[model samples]
Target: MTFPTIPPMHRDLDFNGPLSDERAARLIHSLGPLKGHHVVDLGCGWAELLLRTLATEPEATGFGIDLGEENIRHGRAGAEARGLADQVELEVGDAGAWKGEASDVVFNVGATHVWGGDPVVHTENALTALADLTRPGGRVLFGECFWKRPPTAEEITAMAVIPRDQYRPMPDLVDFALSHGFRLYSLSEATVDEWDTFENGNAWGLEDWIRDNPDSPDFDEVVRLTDAHRRLRLYGRDVLGFAYLTLLRV
Candidate 1:
């Protein structure tokens, strides 16, 4: 079946994840002094946080790489709008293979697949990459999904057909990071309200489109897909959790 072309996620979302402005501010503040430091964001969709970091630290330069051309363009536009175009490089490239000077701050939020691994090993692979990319004493902001609680069989099936084994518990997530040669600095989980906003933002574009284009060819299919997505998200919202870990490279 042909799917409707919906609005882009960046238009509605800021960080492309369940991140609130308050939490984002705290995370940026936790990075300490970034003066004269280089920051890198891998698989950065629109690089909103990266731009924010650069905006906060005028002396810091940033490099953001993502595979999505549209996202890169959006990021570049944001940089220009924020008067940060000269200090940051927002480009479309293979983040996993891109190498550069070790950075003082590295971000791999919600994009572990950039490092190439199976679901079970994705976090580990991303940690390894982050360790290599970050200088000693640098901070890495890692965001990923974890199981808030064990899901029932029906709930698991409703969660986009994803298997329960795809994510570990929160404790295991911390242990996994520590095992990869890092010291945990701070950890926080996305609140239910944040999750609700993110999920709703994900669908609002399509919902608006469906409402405005009732006579369009893809209107019915768009509505159907959006409804299915809402149902699945509701089922998984309580069971799935997203964690943000700030780790110092050892």
Candidate 2:
């Protein structure tokens, strides 16, 4: 199903994830000293994390790669506005194929599709790629969804858009990280409020877009997406959870 184009205002927002700016800042702070280091962000939507890292670590430089043209454009503008144009580079490209410069930190948030469409393959491949790009003792922060509770078969069927095997329990994810030769430094899970904010924000944006473009040909698509977002929020809120895991390369 075709999704509605995100509103321009939404594109200007610094973040497009479940975590709020405060939570994102906390995660950045947890990365230890970034000063004088080089960082890479794969699938860096709008480069929120990259920009934040640059702002926090004035001596650090960063590269952000994303497939979305608008995200790249907005991220570049944001870097310039923050006087970080010299310190950061934003490129429009596939994160999977972009073997980033060997850097101190590598971040991939909510874009596991780089590895492949299959969720299990995507997670494993992404972890491997992140580890390869990070220098020894460097850090990789990966964000993904997991099962919050034991989902019933009916619930799993309802969320069939995502492969059932892809959503592992939290312990299994930790084990997967350990098996990949990385130490789990820390992890931050999104709160229910954060999830609600993300979902409602998307629905609100679509509602505004639909209202403003009532005669547009994409009206039906927008409506469909708006409905789907609401349903997912209502039904999956209890079963689905998101987390940002900080893995230290061994």
Candidate 3:
């Protein structure tokens, strides 16, 4: 699965963006006994899932791959600082390639949706890659976003966001897995409280980011989107994203 061309995007302001290690733990609770296993965290932005796996599984090793070098650098540095240099490897590679030989379980905390808001076509390549790496009966954990219900015309027009059909619905992500020879394991819905909390708190480190790099090209866009998120969450919570966490097994 070749990763498609990525549009200009930035995770620099991701203070509360998407899934955290704390939240991911709850979603992946049933993965059970990672002893002597190999895991790949696809679209491993920041390497949260990989870092957590290495922390918990002393005998297991984890791999993190992403197209963004900045995210990879952060992941590598974190792993090194945690003394997980040996058990964790953060490489700059395409998530769509299943270069690794064997994997017991593969997971992505939150990168699934951002790569492509839709679950079927754009995300299929990532799923194929994960499945290829996993052993028979292996699991794939996808932590992504989706609507609580279909989008309303007014909602999209107001937010200036993509339409619901443009993104794969939550139910479709599961169907995509099954069609690819994978079976459903579990699906965890991120609550309204969860979405609101993360969406609102993403401004945590943004002020410092601005002070440090005010002249950067993406600085303004980052600020703009962040501000937009704050307003939308506070005022328009029901119209947009109600993300979730789900897992599948090959």
Candidate 4:
């Protein structure tokens, strides 16, 4: 099945945007041997994290897959700009249906949530699909939504982007990984610094877009979500959080 494509213009196109590379690096490094190894980044987007990996590990080669043609083109162009074109590549395809040789790591950041709102199904599909691409002892880097302390009423409303009952806690997902032949290697919560930064950066000018242009369901949803996010920032700081997980294939 063909997945919908999200262009760079319509999508968030910033590196680390609000995430700190200095912080995420330690988590990334824990999945070592990336150098001189092939790695596939699922839902690659603009390839910011992949670019960072390419820069850090001189011997590493990268394959970045996304549903968007523009993201692929832009990513390829970025690789060229970095003088790492030969070591980096891109493809447009659905992550669940994609099949290939096992790469060193099947990685994603802020992508697990973009699977059309069904995280359980989406995660299973990813696991089944990615299993084909992961050699024994390989790993998958998942950076996704997580509960901090407890969900507040406002946080529940904001997270209504997905069903409240369907909400899967971070540890729950880690359990899912362990059950499906993937072992949890590391887990870390997103601190206030990263969460606040990402939320604020992504929320910039969102209200203006909604007010100025009333006809965009595409952009309107983005604006609505951003508005709710701003509410959380103003009201529910301690109750909301995002975390990154690293899972190793058994």
Provide C-alpha RMSD values for all models, in order.
Answer: 1.9, 1.9, 5.6, 4.4
| Candidate 4 structure quality by residue, lDDT tens digits, 40-154 | 8888886878877777788988888888677788888888889888888888887555667887788876666434536646666555566667888888877765555567676
Candidates' C-alpha lDDT? 0.89, 0.82, 0.64, 0.68
Q: Which residue pairs show collisions in model 2? A: none
- TM-scores for all predictions: 0.92, 0.92, 0.75, 0.78
Off by over 4 Å in 1: 1-4, 212-225
lDDT-superior candidate, 1 or 4 = 1
Clashing pairs in 3: 118-168
Per residue, candidate 1 scores C-alpha lDDT tens digits across 40-151 of 9999999999999999989999999999888999999899998999999988999989888788999999999887867767777898888888999999999999998999
lDDT of 2 by residue, 84-129 (tens): 9999999999889996566799898888887665666888888888
Which segments of model 3 are wrong by more than 4 Å?
Answer: 1-17, 20-22, 113-120, 204-236, 239-248
Candidates ranked, most accurate by TM-score first: 2, 1, 4, 3
- Return the TM-score for candidate 4, rounded to 2 decimals: 0.78
lDDT minimum window of 10 residues, candidate 2: 5-14
Which candidate, 1 or 4, has the higher TM-score? 1
